[model samples]
Target: MNILHHAVLVKSVNITSVAKLLLDNLLRHVREHVASIGSLSTMTVATLLDPRFKTLGFLSRNKVQEAVRRLKSECTALIASSEASLPHPSDAGESTNNSSELWCLLDETVDQKRQSFNATADAILEVEQYLVEVNLRRHQDPLEYWHKQKHVYPYLYHMSQRFLCSPASSVPCKSVFSKAGRSSANEETAYNHKQ
Candidate 1:
């Protein structure tokens, strides 16, 4: 995008024509494709989680707000599902005649619930605060950063885990496929020569 902008400022006919065409077509394609990409909640969440290009530095205020809301809701759902999967106190025991023990059990359960609730709220707050910080260095890995900060933002960290494994681009996949093909051909040739 910067290259195109600079090319447009040049006083050369050849560069101007090419840059104009590129800018026009590329802008149109990007606008259309970006809108469709925004529809993918997972991808949007992943983009937001990426510290390098958090919010893509271009998403509108409303769009950013909507994405944050969606991320928080998804994180909340995951938290709820995980907690539901755990054994409940009532399910773990039969009613007993010991009132003091029952009171202790109830108090512990309540404390646990409150702690989880506080943790979730803290995670959301941390995410918002993180958004205000300067972007990560270009060389830094967001996965590593998020992984290290998991304890600080447990829910967001878990939410990021779901989306961060995705390949950032198709170039690496194509490169791997070509490398595999070459290795297979080399192995086949070697086997035929030996046989």
Candidate 2:
């Protein structure tokens, strides 16, 4: 984001004609291929969940809201599906007893179902709360925030898991071979100097 911002906004007359042309071409390519940060819902959500970015880093506010809404709906659907898969307490036996055991069983079933819905609601609430809070320091690890608050916001944390696993930037990995080659050459040169 900073790179793109500076690329366009920081132009000076000191730049040569060739460099200006190159900058324009680069901007064109970036606009064509890498302009919209919110195009991918997963990426946008991941950025939103990042402590450094949150909703504040979004280029488009509408996209941030859309991603959050999508996540909330997905969480609600997951809760509903899991609740549907559970065996009903009444299915255990057709016998209706006024016994405390029956009441306890029924109460447990209701509580479980309610808790599922409440969990989803809480997850959405957590996101909303996070959005309102001050952005964390850029140097702080966003995953650490997620880890510390996982118990408090399990649903959001779980939703963020898949997105978090994705590579944020491939530059480091891409440069590994070049870095290795440079280091090996330096080591060989040092060995020759000692000979």
Q: Write down the TM-score for model 2.
A: 0.59
Quote the RMSD, in angstroms, for model 1: 10.4
What tens digits encode model 1's per-residue C-alpha lDDT throughout 53-120?
Answer: 67643346777788778777777667766776676554446455698678778877886887579547
Q: What is the per-residue lDDT of model 2 for residues 19-55, given as tens digits with 9 covering 90 to 100?
A: 8887676555444443354466666666666767666
Point out where model 2 deviates above 4 Å: 6-8, 11-18, 35-37, 81-120, 169-195
Q: Judged by lDDT against the true structure, how good is candidate 1? A: 0.66
Model 1 worst lDDT window (10 residues): 167-176
Which regions of candidate 1 are displaced past 4 Å?
Answer: 1-18, 86-123, 167-195
Native-to-model Cα distance after best TM-score fit, residue 24 in candidate 2, in Å? 3.3
lDDT of each: 0.66, 0.64
